[model samples]
Target: MNGTATHRTVIIVGSGPTGLLLAGDLATAGVPVTLLEKRSHDISNLSRAFGVHARTLEQLDARGLADQLLATGDTITGLRAFDRLTLDLTTLESRFPFMLITPQYEVERLLERRAREAGVDFAYESEVVGLRQDADGVELEVRGADGTVAVRRAAYVVGADGHHSAVRREIGLDFPGVSVIKSLFLADVRLAERPEDVLTVNGAGDCFAMIASFGDGWYRVMGWDRHHEVADDVPIDLDEVKDVARRALGSDYGMHDARWLSRFHSDERQAPRYRVGRVFLAGDAAHIHSPAGGQGMNTGLQDAANLSWKLAAAVQGWAPDGLLDTYETERHPVGKAVLRSSGGLVRLARAQSPALRAVRALVSAVGNTVGPARRKALGQISGIGYRYPALRGAHRLTGTRVPDVALAGGRLHEALRGGRFVLITPDPQAYEDPGTRKDRLTVECWASGRRTTVLVRPDGYVAWAADAPDATAIEEAVAAAVG
Candidate 1:
């Protein structure tokens, strides 16, 4: 490795959400991150994943970007069941009371801006052609816009590239899963009878239709028909996709010209492990599933957030090398759960027989029942149900994500703002500890009379909590977390 041209921390790909989020987090932590992308410029128009869940909003809030996101996107109060059944997610009790329905293009733009503002170095139109890793670090071979190749080195590397990740392939990580089903006709079209307010779903026969009004007259409609087939040579036509929508929704409803159209086949896959040697994977590179719960993109962004902090800690020499291993241990199960939930949703939508439809409706009804049952179902879809397994010697509440609680001064989430670890103590005296640094961990006093403690990460996830305030307990939790 030579002198001037090499980046201290180089990310081998893109303006995409996963890459950008990681870059932004690292940049904000005072880490110099070089983000290389093959795209010449930012993507202006793309109709990919659009639903941003509540948990993601909390993460964005920590970075001071939640208001910006909500301003641009519609606050989806709750997903409507069938056509008329609204779930009223505004009552769900989250920092973000509702899901943010913004297109993927906007998500990318927002993250890119945040990354730039945080000082992430950009190398557009540059692609990582090859990478060589040894005991020390990784040497990446890149080809720039002018077709000139150069070697870039970093202490570590991340494979945030998409489903067909070149980084994963180059690193030879195993992604085991299958293309479970192949049926698609996805489009963004203007409908004659544009459904006002909420999203809709009509599962009748092999005719599966899901439509949501992302404002404007435009609606994202996805449907499937078993008997109908696309010609081998023709890419899925917008007109064909719209015809399926018109047929499934109702023949009388005329489907007009579409703004965008594409075909998709669901794949249920996950990397065997998120990390191998010094390299790691995130986003679509680690897992890919149906977009039913809008979990695919959001999950990837969360992966970036989880890994960035651990990586920054490890690279800065403040944490144990084993801190990085927790990434896979924590996220792999979540990925498995996603595969199960999304795959089930897809199967329910694609179930053609009368018996299956009846069974699905009954299950849905049962799941939506009041109290705990309703909360669980809503939690699953909203990405709030996730909790990592507790570590050894952890308090009963430790490792369990802290419940979103209210405080007299502000909300528990407010203390977690600015992408830092927050230690919530019932006693304000914990702040007097001399060894504890304010910059590394912020101590906030909870006005709630309960003498409990909570530690939250930059992503707004509760990493550790205790039933009572104890300096030893808090210090141990901090050591476990950052170490």
Candidate 2:
């Protein structure tokens, strides 16, 4: 170890939503966090992502951030696919049941603010070029904009940089996947006529287009003409963007005053492993996928949420054996599933062959008519369907996310604002004194008629639950979960 190297408890690379949220969470938990970013601190107005799902809203709500975000975005209670299947989120079980249509920069702005408020050390314009990890800590070689280089050390390091991550490369992790969609064009422009739908998306045989207002005067248009497989750097003509929109949606809503235009491709890739020794990867550094369902940024935020508490536990010296490993075990499956579903959506949208078109029609019909199919599809897309694997002999509720149920003190999510485990039981006496484990657990009586004891994790998942419980079981479960 270098004697003069700057050291922190945790160093997070990339100041995007994932790294910002992770740094905020760690800092909020009283863990010292340093955030490194290659870009300056200036916020950009252009964005590729526009939709935030319900589960992500729930996560933001847990941190008392949902209201601010909701204020900045418009809500769409229903989403249509294939111009036939309508996934209704209005009846979904969440405080924010609809998808929020806002610019990706808005989300990043909120996270960055939270991170700053939490006192995260920001090292902007500093790019991580190399990484080395030993049994105790990880060291990073960072190059500043002025060509100055420095070596920094941290007990743990996380890579939340995008798909072309230097940290992942330095660790020799393989991002094994292929490009799923190519030559997609994106444009942000002023719209003279606003669409009735909050989000309008449709795909024809060889063309696709999606339009969503930023709740500002500007609208984001994303589309692609399958016939044009141009390079990303090629300048995109406004007429081409409008032509694709007209082909897919029948009109461009008088799109004009182009603010931004670009061409890019989407890839479906996942790192072989999320962690290597003391270094870890999250967000785009760990996984990337098509932008079909707007899952990219939301999945990254959830990844940060899943990892932050565990990393905090590890830093605080209370994480049980294998707790840190569970981050990969739980989140890797979710990443794979996102890639599958998002890729499926892209394929469905691009279906042109007679057989594939027929299959797509059948799926749309079934999804529209079948209650379970619609519910499942909406749940998965909105991130409510995800569940971690339960441990042996664990409760049925274990691994499932805890809904924002009404509680005696406040909403279930409100109770989690402090970032502590909440134990709700019909019989509170079953658990030992909360005063003893106040730092790790909070005991509360059930709000209403529920004869079960449920232990909710910091990230809003049910860690353990039982219809009938005793002090011994509660103690053991707590010890097993948080040590």
Show the colliding residue pairs in model 2. none
* Model 2: residues with Cα > 4 Å off, grouped in runs: 1-8, 434-436
For residues 1-483, what per-residue lDDT tens digits would candidate 2 score against the true structure? 223233338999998889989999999998888899999988788878889999999999999999999999899988888868788889798888899999989998999899889988899899998888887888899999899899889889999999899999999999999988878989999887889888988887689999998888889999989999888999888999999999999998999899899999999999989998888899999999999878999999999999999998998888888888989999999999999988998888788899988989999999988888888888889999899999798778899998898887879888998888988978756777646567777778778988888889999999888887778887887777766
Question: How much is 422 displaced in model 1, in angstroms?
Answer: 0.6
Q: Once model 1 is optimally superposed onto the true structure by TM-score, how far is the C-alpha of residue 260 displaced, in angstroms?
A: 2.0
- Cα lDDT for residue 223, model 2? 91
For model 1 the local lDDT of residue 245 reads 61
Alpha carbon lDDT of each predicted model: 0.74, 0.89
lDDT of 1 by residue, 217-238 (tens): 6667777777774533347766
Largest lDDT belongs to which candidate?
2
